[model samples]
Target: MHALFKHLRQVRDGGQRREYSRYLAQRMGPMIHALMLVGALAYLVAVIAGTLVRHSPLPLWLRLAPLPLLLLIAASTRRVRQPGLLSTLTLLCVALLEIGINLNGADDLHRQSVVLPGLLLPVASSVIWLGRWDFIAAMLLCALGPLPMLLSGNIDSALVFQYLVYMAIAIVLSTVLRAFMARTLFEQFRLERQLREQANTDGLTGLLVRNRFLELARSALAELHRQRQPACMLFVDADRFKQLNDQYGHAAGDAALVALAATLRRQTRAGDLIGRIGGEEFAMLLPGNSLEQGCRRAEQLRLSMHEIRRPDGPLTTSIGVACSQRCRDDIQTLLARADQAMRQAKNTGRDRVVCSPDDC
Candidate 1:
């Protein structure tokens, strides 16, 4: 039951449905086709047994009718791109074909019993693959399946009522099961997304964590190296962060850091990557930028930080700029150079930007 619900959830999830459809096309479709072929062969065997042993007068055409339908199902399964649609259509075809066969054998009590149970196949298929609307369609088709027997005057009122009760039970079960599976999948996806965000982002600042930022920076550096394009790293530090904590409190320092993070975000371009690398230290990666351009950007960030007002006073930052041309393609080497430049800014006086030694 658990395995079946998992399959249903895979088919139902909008994000995964397309891939699941392709999987159905490659794997499940062939399995279903094989099952249909086996059913067709079984029908042939049943016809032979009925003729030889029971002396049943079943028409050869009636027995052969399912073959063409089975072939159509195989063709449709192979051609359909959507799994839910394919399953719904296939189940409808199977239900209709079963109904027609049952109509042909309406006079035989044993055959009627065998064929009546086939109506549940669509309900089961719907539960396994169909979303809400498609499941409703499958249920409607299942409800209409026994209509031909009633119209033909082959089935009595009591038998009709019995079939209705059976269908009602199947519908309730399928609906409940599908709803449960959908809820389970939704919760699972939501939890996974939350966990991923928590893992990648800093808890307080809502910026990429040090490790995640480093990973992205390395990737950007590799791309820049391949393209032979220049990139820059800015290592920024709050100029008097320790003083703020000493004067006010840790809370005030934290608020100032959050504000600084927001200012950095506002100052950087869409392509630029920014993260808090340590207490009072932040890093930004500027792709396709030269040393001069990086210095200007860092100055802009430094000025922006100087404008941010706190309860104690205005906050300020020192920024160090290092270009890929001077530091090579290594992230650590580039950051180290940038860190040295940042220290130069801090030493000369706070709230300024300094370039790497080679650039200076």
Candidate 2:
């Protein structure tokens, strides 16, 4: 039940829906092209067969007139980049094909013998559509496409009723096929997104993992450099993480870590980047912060300590601030400097903030 609700939420979320649509279109693009090509060729064959076999009273030019337009729509589908647009274009091609059929059988004399071709399009379209709008539109055209030919020709009323029954069955078949395919694609989309999220984030802290953090930090640093901005990196270490585990059990240590992470999230600006670098270690990148500002922020964090609770009543962190004046340095440089200062803070006495190279 929870999974079903999650799927529904994904379906209703505008951003998620857009993502799913793009994926669906990309995965099915080649198939859509192949099927459209085949539909065009099959349509051409049916038109020619109708003209030759029934000795259609309609001129050959008139019977074949819509063929070029039908192929044009089919060709246009190759360049269709949007999700719903392809469905519309493909349906237009189906419409044109139906037009050609009606033109060939307009003469009452030929309707009886030419009826089968019109019936085929309705059933064969089970896989061609991408959504409800296109499916409904295509089904309408395919279902009634043979009507004029049957009514105008010498066919009896009972045969006409049977043709309608055939179209009903085609509608059911197309609906079931489209629904099954759509559900499968949506489930695949949901599963892939879940895997991506799990891979990119730390399981316990809900923070970006090391490699993902580095990738985003690099991109952000490049942007800041382009704009001639300053940034700071803060390397935070739990001062007695191992001792906490030894004295109070791993559960207390894990609880303290979770609280520490929550504090970092609450204290940072929206633009700042935070990551769990590894066990008992975390890093933060603050865009547009100067050396003094970074040091001030680190001091505030040391004093408050995210309210981490332990058997000894509280826990503390050692923070190192590394700053760039003009955002000229890479993430690696800032990280190295910050790590050095954090080690200094740990050596000189824990629960304090230190700036690299005695700059501040």
Candidate 3:
């Protein structure tokens, strides 16, 4: 039961919901068209047969009156790309068929409304309805659609019971099928997300790589510019990282890098972007942060580096902070200023924070 709930939980995420719905709409367009075609044809055949073979007393034209309306609805189904809209149109089609069947039977109360479209529709439609609510709606309509006609005909209680039981079984089978498909699509979406993240992030630290960081940072900065908000960039370097690697080993160096990445991740906001720009070098882009705030953040981050333990010494990093308002608007210029300040920090002392000099 928990697993079933988990499978259905994919739509809980706003992004996943949008993605799944769009995918569902694209896949369901042709399917909806097919279902509409089938429904229209079946209704047409049932109407004609009732008039000719069953001796339905209603005028053939009155009995077949809904055909044009049905065809119009079917034509509209060709381009519908919204799930809710598609469901509404489908339910409309189903209801039209049910009404048509009811009209066919109005001539004689003994006519079986429980047959034809009602018997087959709910179960048949179970496969195409991607949403649980949509499926339930269709099922209820199919199950109860023929009740008035059936009861008016002096139908046996046993037969109604049999129909209800068959409906229950069909619903269960369709529900299982829906659950299976949701699980499959959800898994596919998750795998695709993982692949995309892997491609964009560093293998060891899981921070954005240099190229991905630059690509996203430019967009973030553009938004900041539009908002007229100050932005800050930080260039962080492990002090004496080469010496530590030489003394400790590449494995130890890798561990230190991972630890630094984790610390950066813990300290930053979700909107802040961190990237492993180079070996022993990382960068952060803080949108809407002023120079003072960036400096303070850098100092706090430098102090936090005091916690990560090592054999010879605690981990220490030199962080350079540069504000967009102080530097040129270009990211490259911001990066260069931040890099210069970082070098200044490294030169003045090993582990410290430095804010870039104003470019303006």
Pitting candidate 1 against candidate 3, the one with the higher TM-score is 3
Per-residue CA lDDT of model 2 for 92-188, tens digit only, reads: 7777877777786676563454456656676677665665667788888888777776777476788788878877877877777776777777788
Estimated TM-score per prediction?
A: 0.61, 0.75, 0.79
- Model 3 lDDT tens row, 174-271: 77777776677668767887898999999999999999999999888888887788899999999888888899899999999999999999999969
Which 10 successive residues of model 2 have the least lDDT summed? 1-10
| C-alpha RMSD of candidate 1 | 7.6
Alpha-carbon runs more than 4 Å astray in model 2: 1-10, 56-81, 108-123, 128-164, 223-234, 264-273, 285-305, 321-328, 337-360
Best first by TM-score, ranked: 3, 2, 1
Model 2, global lDDT = 0.79
Roughly what TM-score does model 1 have, to 2 decimal places?
0.61
lDDT of each: 0.72, 0.79, 0.82
lDDT of 1 at 77: 64
Best candidate per TM-score, number? 3
lDDT of 1 by residue, 1-360 (tens): 555445454445675666544543444455555655555565566556555654445566766677677667766665565666667656656665565456355545534544344455555454344345656766776677656655464446676676677778877777777777555644555566579879998988988899999999999899888888889899999987888899889999899988988898888786799888999899999998888788888877777776889876788788899998633558988888899999999999978888985552
Pairs clashing within candidate 2 = none
**TM value for model 2:** 0.75
Poorly placed runs, candidate 3 (over 4 Å): 1-6, 9-108, 152-159, 325-333, 357-360
